[model samples]
Target: MALLIPASFGNLAVSRRAHVSLTVSASANPRTFHRESVDWVKETASFFDQDKRPIMLFDGVCNLCNGGVKFVRDHDRNRRIRFEALQSEAGKRLLMRSGRAPDDISSVVLVEKDRSYTKSEAVLKIMEYIDLPFPQLAFFMQFVPLFARDSVYDNIANNRYAIFGWSESCEI
Candidate 1:
């Protein structure tokens, strides 16, 4: 139960200048990741400094994921969290940058400063950035071992689509 899951895409070529320019960015067409197009995409779409805010990349089409984002957005009193649909170019790049598979949208991803968190760790770390009760709750939950926490997370994630449905396109 590591904080970051090893990226399925091994030895992905790193791009030096991919940056997000907007608070949130979403795209209709999911493109095949290409290293040479990174600079070109930066000029056209949203890419920015990861240091500006914590970016949460999630399953764009999953109803549960979208609902979760809405929940975070509502409770995030400081408004410090930024979001990018995992289907979006910005999200894909961020995933690659964090050494994650760009196509793997099974778990939520939280990219903050120079580190990345996934699964239960990502969810809990995100709670730390939210309002009073959540931060307190997250602090208490930290005492639980990672393996146990991630087991619950995986169960929910694996069954999310059946329980919550999915969308043809990303709405948030």
Candidate 2:
């Protein structure tokens, strides 16, 4: 059985097994779902640790996602972000604990102290920690309405495999 719960981000499909899957509608801006439910935050805290460095979760088999991880690692001179492929055990655990479906790896997830950011919001938050022009670009991009930004994001995500191809296993 599945229970439908209304959240600030979108409607959540909570399975009887307690798995939570985020379902975003075309009319809803993905950024609007920034606040993770308090219960979720509390549950994931032990696994993620409240004070550790931020973790970036990406699709391991996607060439584009892997490239993105490499770009962030290269640009992050301070090394503020640690990455894990969505298929990894740590990644799967975090996703389940945070109420997201482990198999839904279309979006890059930025897991911070008390919250997780997905889609365009995740990209922008990651950019804020990177060096030079990226932060500036992120700041500029902020003005583009969240829905509009996520629309572009969704288009790319939907075709990422077709455009970038996928490996049988995660490269990282």
Candidate 3:
């Protein structure tokens, strides 16, 4: 079961186990994942305490997703972000914290400063943390409406597998 909460751009479906105060933007269709009973707020707090850097979660087996992660790693001269595969334990926990199903890999998710950005918002926000020209480019792209940006994003994401291919196993 899920509780629907009104959000700025879309409705948020929060899971019963989600206790963290996370602002989710441009999320995908909601799905439920079974979670073991635990104190989620405390767990997330301790995890973030260990590392303050923002986390980027992606589809580990998708070639395009892996390429994007590599791009961020190479361009992020400051190394301000950490990465996790959406199928990994850490990624699953973060997804649950943000009220997303662990098995849902429809879009890349960025968790930073107690908020989550998904779909096109995650992509642009990621550019902001990377190298110089990308940030400038992202700033300019903000002029485009969210719906338009996400429409293109969804198109690419939906076809990523056929266009970019996928690996048999998760990597990086």
lDDT of 2: 0.74
lDDT per residue as tens, model 3, 53-101: 8899998888999999999999998998999877766776677666776
Write the residue-wise lDDT of candidate 2 on 48-155 in tens digits: 555488889998888899999999999999998989877665675566544686556878999876677899999999999999999999999999999999999999
TM-scores of all candidate predictions against the true structure = 0.73, 0.73, 0.76
Residue pairs with backbone atoms closer than 3 Å in model 1 (clashes)? 19-47, 19-48, 20-47, 20-48, 21-47
lDDT of 1 by residue, 105-162 (tens): 7789998755779999999999999988998999999999999999999999999888
lDDT of each: 0.71, 0.74, 0.74
List candidate 3 stretches off by more than 4 Å.
1-41
lDDT of 1 at 130: 91
Specify the highest-TM-score model's number.
3
Q: Clashes in model 3: which pairs?
A: none
